[model samples]
Target: MSEQAGSPLEDLTAGGPAIDAFELLANETRLAILVTLWESYRPFAEDTTLQFSELRERVGTADSGQFNYHLDRLTDHFVDATDDGYRLSDAGLTVVRSVIAGTGIEERTLEPTTVDMDCKLCGSPAEIAYEDGWVYVFCTECDGLWTDRSDDERGQLARFSLHPAALADRTPEEIYAAAWLTTYQKLHSMIEGVCPTCSGPIERSVVVCEDHEDDGICGNCGRNGRGAARLSCAVCKEWVQSTLGSIAKYHPAVVGFCYRHGLELQYGVESLAQIERRLDEATSKVDLVSETPPRVDVTTEMDGDEIRVRLAEDLTVLEVSERTA
Candidate 1:
């Protein structure tokens, strides 16, 4: 196809070079400057600029030439140069926040506890622990951790620590499971006109299965498939994708169903053919509401009893009905 006049592709292909951005961030001093500006200007007066001397004092760098060199490198990319002095550019704040989330926090181990679930391989009690901000559920008898050994620990830890209150008073297994569910729920909520992350508008869509044909398994949990839902925050650009089943576990109707059937919604349950058979028998329909901001409605029926759940775009329970068949 021929390129059109003033096409968006022109702007996308007009960048000086992609590596130039990374090259700017390669220096320790430049990164420190961004972090320093981010800390001073955030949460209250992000638009507030700092004088060069004020910023330099906060950074604790005695050498003016060295600091200026680093600051100039960030200009027009991460740092915005102004007559008042300097402030973090939008891109600068993003880089600094990412760095803080990635490596700025201190690592510590939380108190370990035994959970209610047992190992699928050995039938022994499962143990849950938190270390370096990542929750771990493991079976001592089987030496099996819920996560894969080769996954990126940094990204995992960052995601968990994003919402610390969600982790409180929860076992490792619960935390691990809830982390995915809660984020899924929040992302769904964003799609439904409320954002749990930033109270911003959200956009959501069903991911084409063919687009992810190569992703046959999750590298982190070793789950055998990808999720269908894809949600993006219009303001924050936060995005999440997870299976309907995984996200649905948090629904009131699903929770009630699990309680009524004495079935636990955890990792190993789906792998068991008997449990899958039971779930299949109980679940009558998983319907996706076809609207601009879509909803997922799930129905379950068993032994003359039935429950219908209507979920908002963000997966929040909008309506739930229980009836006897």
Candidate 2:
């Protein structure tokens, strides 16, 4: 956290100090200092620094010389030393928050349980499960959303990232909704040329299948759909890939169409199931309009009205046309 104002591109590409950040945090005492500083952090307070003696007492490290040595090791990079005392730097705060969020800690797993919603594809009952930091939803019958995404080869409907903290004070159905909403927000941000993780600019491109097939699982491309939008943030290296229909889910034309059809993309388990159903149905008609300039037209049909969203080379909404089927 230097006082210098650096652009995101400069921050990613510029060469800086040769210090190894991981090597600096390898000590137990150094990590304890960071956690203690985070414990005393107050956002709006005028003074939030912890004195040397107070921090040492809370960490329970008796040796004064050893404590000072560890504190000096963290200065400027992780912890900031001030005239009054010490406070956590921006990097230190990030580390502590990530640790508390259970990023590296394997907390628990949940077995697949039948959800209250049914599969949009086959109308069979859908199941939800949590394992290894991902929430999965799949149909028990015909290919839910895709066929080959799971190890057990269940009809995978959705798989999104979820931390262990989401399991607290919530049921399995609620957990699915939370994960779905989070992923929806991320996808919307990515489609708008922003990184959902770091708020940096993103680059987008479409991957079109040469020989497309769409009978549950595609035999030509191996994916369930004809094209996917891939996004990458150069600053943070955050990556996201989704079907063309998913990227266009929040378009005003599409939202209006769903509204007319009685599908509300709200924040709930049932609403998420509706959204998934819409995506599954929309993928069936995705056409690769052009390969040289990379254009994809996604079609959504319901109630005898058809709406097509055309995405240009950059994946931005190029046009919206409606017709009666």
Clashing pairs in 2: none
**Candidate 1 residue lDDT tens string, 286-312:** 665655566666667666677777666
- Return the TM-score for each candidate structure: 0.49, 0.82
Instruction: Name the lDDT value of residue 257 in candidate 2.
Output: 78
> What residue runs in model 2 are displaced by over 4 Å at the alpha carbon?
1-19, 42-47, 104-106, 147-150, 256-284
Best-performing candidate as measured by TM-score: 2
Candidates' RMSD to native:
10.0, 6.1
Residue range 37-86, candidate 2, lDDT tens digits: 99899998898899999999999999999999999989989999999999
